[model samples]
Target chain A: MSSAVEEKRKHQKAQKKADRDAALAKKAELNMTSLMDIFVNVLIYLLMNYSTSPVDVPQSKEHTLPQSSTKLEVKHTTTIAVTKKIIMVNRKKVCDVVKNTVDPSLKKDKQASSYLITPLFKELKEDVQKQKKIAKYNPSAAFKGEVTIVADQDMSFRLLSEVMYTAGQAEFSKFKFAVVKKGG
Target chain B: MGKKIRQEDATEEINIMPLMNIIMLLIPFLIMSTEFIKIGVINVAAPKIGGGASSSEPKKKDEKPPLNLTVSITEKGLTILTRGKKIPEGCDLKGEATEAKLPTVKKIGDKHNLPVLKQCLQTIKEVFPDERRIIIMAEPEIRYSIIIDVMDHSREGKTADKDMFPEVVLSAGVL
Candidate 1:
């Protein structure tokens, strides 16, 4: 009787162990495969879009940098980005833009349809003042009146000139147009 | 039974901790390395505020370079002008610029004819080898893409070793 009881106990224990192992394996199998696949995909995407440039602009769906064969490297400066929707000065929203041009109301001299954008000029002037203040403390880091204009390839030339002309009015003289470096 | 449960728990915990650690490290690494877009620059001279000439140097009276190379883009097409004189292109060979202009090169589509434009600039380069500056002007409605493409095409020829006119000064529209 004792030996028979012992055999019954052993069989029960073995069945319980098998059931536990099977449940654990099922759970792990389901999660591991899908999770691993997801992680691998995410990592690949991140690797491809990684950039090494010191200065960069976020390229949106509507905007793309014009391709250039020139070997000029982008320098750090006050950035003015013109999108289809709006114009930005140093990553701050300055004014709204339209399809082919800026709204006249947003400009300084609205009646004349002036090229000088009011908000952009004010913002850039503030930036120049701040830079000048910083330069005063550190003589070696004198302010350079440089501005980088980032815009879509399809943006109109008139808007570009307006931005440059306004920047010029606000003490910025050096103009650099951002582009994607590529072969012809 | 209690000892066996503890051992299983330990193994499960170990499996997740290492994986979590790895993912934690990897995610930050990828994020730190990622930037939205890479961009280069084309240094363009600021438009002359109140200009006699867009050139950086103050002009002497009655003195001008032999070639005041100017390239203009309008609704018609590109018109390369030297000292206000247009460079006429193939078959449109009339003495008058307005009468006969450089027609857009047609291969598959109505593109800017950049390569042919480059070739014309190259020809100009041979004679005015010392001239490094070129003024680019376009109509108000012209796309910035066309302007920059023209600038890039004329900036370098074949390679960086062969520069055509790297210095570009943007001029206001003719209109």
Candidate 2:
């Protein structure tokens, strides 16, 4: 009986050792090479398309852009965004839009069917002057009189015209209307 | 001696823990920085003030008038007019006249009949292949988004695989 009990203990010990070895082998079996390859490819792709330019306009829920089939790429310029409630120049609110028209109080200079809004004109003028000053100092950077308008689809032409006219009066002759690129 | 030789020949495992941590951090950073919505631009020249004529010389009586194509958008639909004369039976401008007596276009599929409007514009484009400018006259109540869509349609004719009217002049519709 004593010899039999000793044999049983030895068998249990061997079984436990085998189980532990199997667990360890399983733990060491992970192939990180494939995972590392996938990560490297993803990183390469992301790095290639990474935009370093700081002039990208932040899209928001209120400022959904109209879709277009045009192939023209957007360039860095002063952006004026018109939403349902407000008109913003470079993300700063210049005036409020109500009932498809800019608030009368915001228009300091009132004329019949006036295209220029006072607050917007002042903001765009400052931007143009600052750009001109920068171009004067930096020979490589030239002021191109470019302005980009990113307006909501629900906005009316009256407000757009006023904004464009105001920007034009501010000496921004070249206008670019921002649109969401459609399709591949 | 054989066991010792095998152990010596084993390659050292590289410590990729730091690299893994860096890559994990970089992925989220890149995703957050990436602009998913690709922004495009439609160039527009500021409208010339004072209505200055292109040429200094007086126009000859026999010379054909410039093709001043105007696409007027009202509540009913789109109206294609050339030199102030409406294109007969081409447009489907069908809606109740507004208080201002301006006919508006019916909205088909979240927008005015853009397909029909494109077809109409394409026909006009074939007639005046050389003319590239179109004046988009929209009502004050018309959404700016609709105007842009009309501009896009008028700017290029897809069936022809050519630009119909590249130059767009925005104007408030005749009141």
Candidate 3:
């Protein structure tokens, strides 16, 4: 009779332990606060490291760049185009008032277009300053306030050197020279 | 109230100690293995005047004679000048008796051939084994790769010889 009574007591204790484990498992399944905290932290990391551009180039027919294999699709806020015979500062053909290509001998001949580089240089300087102003308003903006030059492959080094000198005079130290891969 | 108390006791706090330990170990490992690029260079000296061109001064009979090798690259072909004269015929591109040169037709790898410029450097390597220094005045319009190839051929087979390594100085001028 005593043995039977002890067995009944052990069976009741085991049933209570099984009920406690099932209730704990159900509580864990419903508690989503910890998982939500982990997800929020991951989302924050992704947003902070994302490469977002503040100034994107608007679609325009005037800015058709020559295709190049080495050309990186850069989101430049300030762009300058130095064509075969003309210099385009901020999409305006300021180098040549007319549609004539830049003639290298014009500098030697003392043409009016050669001296117009001073105003072009001033415009480039102002564009860089404006980029900095826009970036200042937003801390997340990665604008370096630099200008990208798109030059023709056949352009003489002497002409290219002049552009470099003007950019240097305007205090724009960062430059990326675009070139197509050889044999491309 | 009883159920809420049980839930609080069952869950433990998230541990960040192991993550921090791994990051600390990784930072030091990266710092230790970082490598910087190294550039190689060599110092050079010009040879002294001897029994060659400036013969106006008196000569020393007991001194060792200096070897004079002339390496020229013309529009026509290469010309090797030794002892102040051209080598024998059949070596020049035009087969002229006045010009000492190699067959301007040798290929670089079946694609690029040694132009008159490269042939001049190679001929200099063969004739005067000791005269390893050369001055090349090339045309401005010649491709930069052609100039580099001439310098490369200057010390071709004997690059590791240390003594025969040629020192070729290049300059650009109007042809």
Candidate 4:
């Protein structure tokens, strides 16, 4: 009788071990099919929207760009932004544009002969010199003298022309106006 | 032989678990780095300084000079001038023509006339398909934003689905 009781206890122990082993195996098997499906969808969406162009101008509250239906792609270049009250180059304030006109103090040349703003011209000239020096060492990269202007819509053409003229004097001949894409 | 066959089958099953792990990490990285705002550009050439003639060809006595399209922005509305002559009564945006000069007070809803100016430009574009240059004249008090909007309309005829005048020359309104 004791032998039979021992055999029955051993059988119970084996069954409990089997049950625990089965539970662990079930827990270890992770179904990654759903997770993979989600990842693939997200990857495709991001890849579709990815832009190969290098220029990425950050928009701010003070300087809102005008909307347009142009399809020209913006390339990476030096940026000159004209806000309601100030003019900036690469996020640095070069001078002030007050009430649709460049500040009188900043004007070096008379309005009739030249529209080049003094402080802006000096700053842009330095930037061009620095870029040219960098291009000398890096043979693969060349300076294109390209610049983008981001000006507030409410500002006058006088300010825009002054900024463009100053940039031209600084050896920046190519001009591009940064605008928000209309519709989508 | 049976054990060898089983080993070959196991090797044939590609271990994609590592690839899946890498993809999972890349998705979040790309999502964070992606930019939302789409930026575009309008290429513009600087205005020429002097009025020197480019062509050396001798002028004919009866040959009419080429039409120079100029859109002047005033306080009342837009005035479309072609070769110094105003086109017609339809180009005016204030519902009536006002001969107001510069430093005139900008009225509300004055920008709504841009579409009318665009229509006039479209007709001119149909006549001269190759003409891509336009002179934009604005008052000193005119906002920069309005000038941009005018350029946007004059640069391309959106309704006509054609390039009207992409070259814009900025000038002060003298009339």
Candidate 3 per-residue lDDT over residues B43-128, each given as its tens digit: 11111210112223354463545444434444443334444445433344224443122423333453334444444545555665
Model 4 clashing residue pairs (backbone): A153-B144, A153-B145, A154-B144, A154-B145, A155-B144, A156-B144
Question: Judged by DockQ relative to the true structure, which candidate is superior, 2 or 3?
Answer: 2
Report the C-alpha lDDT of model 4 over B1-175, residue by residue, as the tens digit.
3645567676664566897989978877887667676778888755544112221235446455657778777777676767766655554322334454312223346454666667778877877777787887766677766777788888777654667898777664345
lDDT over C-alpha atoms for residue B28 of model 2: 87
lDDT of 1 by residue, A33-108 (tens): 4665677787888888776665567788667788876678888899999888888887899888778688888787
* Candidate 2 structure quality by residue, lDDT tens digits, A1-184: 9999999999999999999999999999777777888898898888877765444766676678889888788888899988878898998998888767886656745663666689998998899889989999997888877788888888887777778777777888777889888884
What's the residue-level lDDT of B88 in candidate 2?
Answer: 46
Clashes in model 3: which pairs?
A85-A101, A85-A102, A86-A102, B91-B101
Off by over 4 Å in 4: A1-30, A84-86, A91-93, A96-104, A109-115, A130-145, B4-17, B48-66, B91-110, B158-161
Query: In every candidate, what fraction of the native interface contacts is reproduced?
Result: 0.66, 0.62, 0.00, 0.54
Q: Write the per-residue lDDT of candidate 2 for residues B1-175, one digit (tens) a residue.
A: 3646566457767767688789989998997777766778888765544112221235346477877788888777676777766654434233233434323334565558887777877777777788888887777788877888898888877753678898877665442
Residues A85-179, model 3: lDDT tens digits: 55777677657422323444434345633422465677777876776677789877745434565555444333444564455555554444433
Docking class of 3: incorrect
lDDT of 4: 0.72
Score candidate 2 by lDDT.
Answer: 0.75
Model 2, runs deviating above 4 Å: A1-30, A52-55, A110-114, A138-140, B1-13, B47-64, B91-110, B159-161
Each candidate structure's count of clashing pairs: 0, 8, 4, 6
- Reference-based lDDT, residue A159, model 2: 77
DockQ of every model listed?
0.43, 0.41, 0.04, 0.42
